[model samples]
Target chain A: MTAAPRPAPVAIDDPADPRLAPYTAMRERDLVGRAGRFIVEGEVTLRVMLSARARFGLESVLLAPERLAGLAEALARLPGDVPVYTATKPVMSAITGFPIHRGVLGVGLRGTEAPGAPLPGLPPALAPALVVGLVGLTNHDNVGGLFRNAAAFGADAVLLDAGTCDPLYRKAIRVSAGAALIVPFRQLADADAILAFAARHALEPLALSPGGGETLAALLPPARTLLLLGSEGPGLPPDLMERLRTVRIPMAPEFDSLNVATAGAIALHHLSRSA
Target chain B: MTAAPRPAPVAIDDPADPRLAPYTAMRERDLVGRAGRFIVEGEVTLRVMLSARARFGLESVLLAPERLAGLAEALARLPGDVPVYTATKPVMSAITGFPIHRGVLGVGLRGTEAPGAPLPGLPPALAPALVVGLVGLTNHDNVGGLFRNAAAFGADAVLLDAGTCDPLYRKAIRVSAGAALIVPFRQLADADAILAFAARHALEPLALSPGGGETLAALLPPARTLLLLGSEGPGLPPDLMERLRTVRIPMAPEFDSLNVATAGAIALHHLSRSA
Candidate 1:
């Protein structure tokens, strides 16, 4: 046999190495300033990115030496050649600005495609699909949970309104257990753009509200639907609320609204079942 | 002019003051070693407690002087007389071991009665009701959310399995938006007991599973039902899964599962609609 295949190695002992710039800059919340790429942490999420053939360009995967043992087997399953970087735990922590428990992290380019665009002659079965619009939901975990729900409930796409957090944020990716990598999503400029898209596609916009006009069962329409959800505190903005068909999940008399992500999942499940 | 009836007042500045023991001990997660009474933070949750007529033996309602003004007005609508403590923000923070963002907090007794007992011979129409069972879920937020969903979806009561987290944990109370107080709940010593209770009452045990045997819509019975939910990672224990009637919410092909609380909400909503 030819000499054992050489492992793709890039030793990074210095946390300040210029080659590790992309990884270092992600430590700040203001990651938008450093690069347009999204950070996907943990081995599971990185594995999904490699398998999905998603458009996010891989920069490099960094991990502690021990993590590389497990990652090597996972990498063997992927088709493309990508750079792998290994560092000591201390150096990895210093570069990432935090101790990464998952041992593996990958920096991938953020997809720039606009959400809701026709997928080059989309199939009829995929048409008339259920889509979710997130508004002012800033929590990374909530955003991740929503994506997970959307995927589980058969939502075709997820659209983020201006105020929502980045779905590609590291915490979101980790929280989603990499489901975020498989789901297609894009950010809309504003709520009006979301409504216009819904109107254009003949998708009835159903705003989920605690004080909604009708129970979800009564308000569901037999057409392509868009479920609109708002932030935890100041629910769907008044303007957005006015534009969509309001549907409520009739709750017990005394309880307040469900968590935003939970409400979305419930609505998506109902809508998909009805569809 | 006769002075308006003054609210009960309690003054204590020292963090070690005996009168403020409950409030002080709550700073630690143990909630003063009672492990039952959860701390409810913020004016909103407190307002929920006051309105639900929850049997809260209020040790004290601590608030900053400014925050106290509005709460004073809201408290007027409450049915029982409860002491309202006023303190400086720093003083309150020092006693509670955390910043009181809502500038309000309450020390309330956790309900000890098992939720399974029939509600004092209520009418038949009201008697037959859907209830939620918290099995292995240990997250405080998840427990609170389950209660919130139960209350919202018109569940009769919430039953917590022995392994589940305490619903009265301050975090759970906060996450539930105080729904924890209004929705009646009972903690069981074992899940088997809950299963037996459901069996005796003719309540079918509908276990939620990501890869469940039937859709939630099909699993719901025409009579009283108990929706059983497992924790996030290692879903319903293997033994528990074997015993209950398994059901799943239909999800997108590539997605895994909805968050446990989200799944519960969807199930509750579906069952409520069918009812």
Candidate 2:
């Protein structure tokens, strides 16, 4: 089927326009279970989202009026029901919490699905995909970077533990450079269920530690893998460590460990390529 | 020689005490070119410094009185002339521009040139070592993470090319968890010089790219190798790519590239183990 006709352009001159409420309110909203959405800003992430076919039901596209002419062709290609909101730079900044660096922002509905149904219909061959589990990683920037890396390195999905921060948090979304939306992910239950599920799927679970058995390269698992990582200071809890194979990225004689997200990326990259 | 006696302890009730000047003006003070002067905060990093046998020409050690009482035994063990400044939490925070989460801060002289000197004394069999090159990475956190990873993955040294950020920035030092101090590194003139130096040392230089010729596993050079990394947004520059053997970490379809520091960790982990 041909794509839907482009959305009608809606000009927004006043920053206080009532139609822009949801977009503006996004800045201070709790966002955990909110039906409204977060924004994906800048050209690169915007392009990534469009190409991924993840933005099929866009709520509205906001842009600075002066830059609207530059994005006209791309704007013309979006689905018809998606309204395009044009605002001055100052108004857009006021609506969002920060300066509008990318000149484009896509407001989308928050997505929800049962944690168990991360991927709907993939067969067993794709069954035991590489999933990176994040536990207690509170830094939004780090979480965002991890998602970006996960998307870049091709982790099948990201599973966040109970204490982990919301992936849709504005800072997290911006930090992921919008990759959080594109990457297949779910906020799973606690670490126990995550480990049990991996075990059930025959996915070898490996916990990254500074002082683990074999170096990551030496213990590249034969089956699908789950690279489990924890926050910076207090690494994987001893209880969790008891459930999985502990592996480390070997370092020089003096250094201790890499940053949590960096370590995660390395482990994900290794698992992606080896599998 | 017997270790110098630990410096006398001093107590200051006021945040504005003149003796607390260096600690207070740390961020505002330009640190480059200063000999034997650097800041270390937090217990873990402080422990790392103490254990590394880093020269203890410490200018001052600032601690909250509560922390001081707990660490008094350890403080008593320090060598001569190392001054300890005790203050209340507010005074400590006021002096350092933030709460001292580690509850301890040490201003020590930056070590002189002994560590950075060429390893000319080693036998021919051990002449060459693995060196990791970082190019155009300006983020302090990234730089800090790179150093920490470099040290963990047994990289002998980190070579910084022009356009890179200072590895000694305060944020970098803290983020590195203080491994930045322990890892032997030097800033180089240009990428060309680094390439030439690697060639001279019989070190194989592998430039990382998202779509390089071979997977990192297949293309890692012999034991003596150098892994080159670029900034997060752009991979290696075209000229540097032309000068070195290129390799890629095979990633999943639709993913872009891993973060520069994460990529470095993976490469270092892979190459070091195989070597």
Q: Write the per-residue lDDT of candidate 2 for residues B22-56, one digit (tens) a residue.
A: 78765665444244467777776666666634433
The interface RMSD values of the models, given in order, are 1.4, 1.8
Q: Positional deviation of A76 in candidate 1, in angstroms? A: 3.1
> What TM-score quantifies how close candidate 2 is to the native fold?
0.84
Q: Across residues A1-275, which tens digit of lDDT does each residue of candidate 1 receive?
A: 64445467687899999878778855674456445677878777888877743546677788888887777766665444567888888898888788866668777876455554663211244356687888889898889988888778667778788899888888888877777776777778888887887777667788898878888766545468878888888988887687667888776665557778888877777788865
State how far residue A43 of model 1 sits from its true place (Å).
Answer: 4.0
Question: Best by TM-score, which number?
Answer: 1
Per-residue lDDT tens digits of candidate 1, residues B1-275? Answer: 95467567566678887666677745565544564555778877888776735656555577777886688777765444656777888888888787766678777776455454664212245356687888888888788878778777778778787899877778787777777777767777778988886776677788888867887766646577888898988988888887667998777666666678888888888887766
For residues A34-107, could you state the per-residue lDDT of candidate 2 as single tens digits? Answer: 56566667765556556644532467778877778777776766667778888877788888666776668777
* lDDT of all predictions: 0.75, 0.72
Q: How accurate is candidate 2 locally (lDDT)?
A: 0.72
Candidate number with greatest DockQ:
1
